[model samples]
Target: MKNLRDEFPLIAKNKFAYLDSSATSQQPKCVLKAVDDYYKKSHANPHRGTYCLSVEATNAYDFSRQKVADFLNAHFEEIVFTKNATEALNLVAFSYGSFLKKGDHVLLSLMEHHSMIVPWQRACKTHGATLDYIKLNNNFELDLDDFEKQLRKKPKIVGISSVSNVLGTKNNVKQIIEMAHSVGAKVLVDISQSIAHEKFDVEKMDADFVVFSGHKMYAPMGVGVLFAKEELLEAMPPFLLGGDMIEYVYEQETTFAPLPQKFEAGTQNVGGAVGLKTAINFLEEIGFDKIKEIETELTKYARAELKKLKFVECYFTSNAKNHENVISFNLKGIHPHDVASILDSKGVFVRAGNHCAQPLLRSLGLNSTCRLSLSLYNTKQDIDKLVEALKYAYEMFFKTK
Candidate 1:
C-alpha cells in the first residue's frame, strides 16, 4: 500500500507503533499547516464580525463547514461544529430527544461507546422514556433479528454505530436504519470509528442524524461534525446557550440564530475546522478505496498473526472480513494493563481497559482487553511489533507454567 506515512511528523520521528488510531489519528503535516495557517493568517470570531480579519476568519470557517457538507453530500446549513462526537451525540440526546415523551422508547446497539449510550440513558430517564439495546449475536456482531424485534418496541429514536469501536464489527446500518424508519423511529448513526477507514454518504445512509469526530479521522481534536437534515436542525432546540448562537438578546427575551449557528454556541474552533477540511482533502486525495484496501490487508494480517498466538484469546469474529479496524484480545492469564505496559516499553502502542464501552466488555465477560486499532497509515511492521510484544507479554506472564 502506498501510504502517506511520512506526511505525519510524529509518525516519522517516533520509532513507535501507533496502533491507537481509533482513539484518535495522528495529524498529517498538511492538516497541521492548515490549522496553523488558520490561527496565524485568519484569526477572529466568525459569523458576527464586520472587520477585514473577522470576515476572513468567517470565510475560512464557513469554507471549512461547506467542505464538510460537500464531503457528506449534505446541505450547507445542516452541518454543526462541536468539540467532538461526544458533544454531537449529547446535542441530539438533549435537543432532538426532547421530542420524547412518557413511555416512548430509545434503542441502541450493545456495542456503542459511552458517548452514545449515556446521553440517551439520561435523556430517557429524564423524559420518562424507556431505553433498550439490540443484542449481539455469537459472532459479537449486532443481531439483525433481535434488532428488528426491538423495533417492535416502536422506539421514538435509535442510536447506533456504523462500526463498533471495540470490536471492529460493522453493522448493517442501512438495513438497520430502514427497519428503524419502518417503525417510525429517527436513527442517529455514530461513524466515529469507521469514518477514517470507510466512505459515507449520509443522504444515502438515510439517517436522521450522524455524528463524527475530526480527530478520529486525522484532524486535530476539538472539532466534530453533526450532520442533520436542515429541517431537523430547525426543529430541535440548541444544546448550549451562549454568545454567538444568539439572534438578538433582549432584556427579558432572546432569539436564537438559524440552523448551523444555533447549535454552535461560544467561540467556534475555526482552526480545528480548517484542519478538518485539510485532513479530509488529504484522505480524498488518497481515495478511500485505497485506504480501505491497505487497512483491511493489515487487519487481516494482524488477526492471522494474533490467531497463531494460541495463548491469546481473540474477541474478534472468526470471519476476518467482518472486523477490520480493531482487534481486541487478551493474553491468557495476564491483565490487559500489564500486557499494554509491556507493549509500551517496546514502543508498540495499543489501548487497554474497557475502551469506554463498559457494557460491551461486560457482555464479553471481560473487564478489559488490549486493542490494536488499525489506520491506513499503519504498516505490517507495526503489526509485527505488536505481535512480538504480545509474545513477550505471554512469556513474562506464564513461562513457568
Candidate 2:
C-alpha cells in the first residue's frame, strides 16, 4: 500500500498515531491550501453582493455544491450545506418531520450516534409522534427481523446510520431503504462515518435523504451536506428562517427562497465548502479502491493483533469480518479514560468514551470503551505502536494488582 502520510502536515511533523478518523479526519495540505486560497483570492458574502469578489465567491460556492452533487451522484439542487451532519439531520427532523402527526412512528436503529438520535427524539416529542428502535443481534449487527417487525408497524419516517460510529458496522442501508419505502416511509441515512470510506450514490441507492460531515471526510469543520430528493426538499419547509433563504419579506408574512437556499438560511462557510471540494477531489484522485484496500488491510491487521491480547475485550468479536476500520474494545478492569490517557502518554491517540452512542454502549452493557478508527493514512506500524502502548498500560495498571 502506498503511504500518503506526507500529504498531511500534522502527521508528517508530529508522527503521532491518529486513530480517530471516525470522529474527524486529519486535513491534508491540499484541503488547507484550498481554504486559504479561497480566503486570499475571493472572500466575500456569496449570493448577496453584486460585486466581482462576491460573484466569484458565489460561483465558487455553487461549484462546490455541484462537486458534492457529482460525488454523490445527485442533482445540484438536491444538496443543502449546513454546519454539520447533526444540523442536516435536524433539518429533516424539524422540516420534513413536522408533517408527522400523533401516533406516527419514527423508526431508528440502536446503532445511531447521539446526533442522529436526539434530534428525532425532540422531533417526535414536538410532533406527538412515537419513536421506535430496531434491535441489535448477538453479533452486534442490526437485527433485520426486528427491523421488518418495526416496519410492519408502518412508520412515517426511518432514520438510520449507513455505518455505526462506534461498532464500525456498515449497514445494508439500500436494503433497509427499500423496505422502508415499501411501507411508504421516507428514510434518512446518516452517512457521516461511511461517506469517506465507501462509495455512496444517492440516486443509485434511491435514498430519500442523506447527511454527512465534511470534517469526517478530510475537509475542514463547519461544513456538512444534506442531500434529499428534489421533490422532498420542495415539500419540506425551511428549518431556519433568515436572510439568504427569503425570497421576499413583508411586515406580516415572508416568502422563502428556492429549494436549497431556503434551507441554507445564513451566510455559509465558503472557505469550508471550498476545502470540502478539494477534499473530495483528493479522495477522487486516490480513489475508493485504494482507500478500501488500505483500510481493509489495516483493519484486519489491527483486529488480529488486538485479539492476541488477553486483556483486551473486543466489543464485536464475532462479526469483525464486517468491521470497516473501526475497533471498539475495553481493557479488562481498566476504565476507558485511563486507557486513553495511557495511550496518549505514548503518543497513540484513540477515542475513549461512549463515542456518542450511549444507547448502543448501554445495549452492550458497557458505559465506555476505547476506540481505534483507521483511514487511508493509517499503517500497520501505527497498530504496532498502539499494541506496544497497550501492553505498557496493562503492565502499569495491573502489575501491582
| TM-score, model 1 to reference | 0.98
Worst 10 residues of 2 by lDDT: 315-324
Error of 1 at 63 (Å): 0.4
Candidates in order, TM-scores: namely 0.98, 0.98
Local distance difference test, candidate 2:
0.92
Question: Over the stretch 1-401, how does candidate 1's per-residue lDDT look in tens digits?
Answer: 33488888999888999999998899999999988888889899887778899999999999999999999999889999999999999999999989899999999999999999999999999999999999999998888899889899999998999989899998888998899999999999999998898888988988899999999999999999999988889989889998889999999988999878899889999999999999899999999998888888998898888889889899887766678789899988899999999999999989999999999999888999989898887899999988888888888877778
Ten-residue segment with the worst summed lDDT in candidate 1?
A: 1-10
Model 2 vs. true fold: TM = 0.98
Model 2 C-alpha lDDT per residue in residues 210-309, reported as the tens digit of each score: 9999999999999999999999999998898889999999999999998789899889999999999999999999999988888889988998999999
lDDT of the structure predicted as candidate 1: 0.91
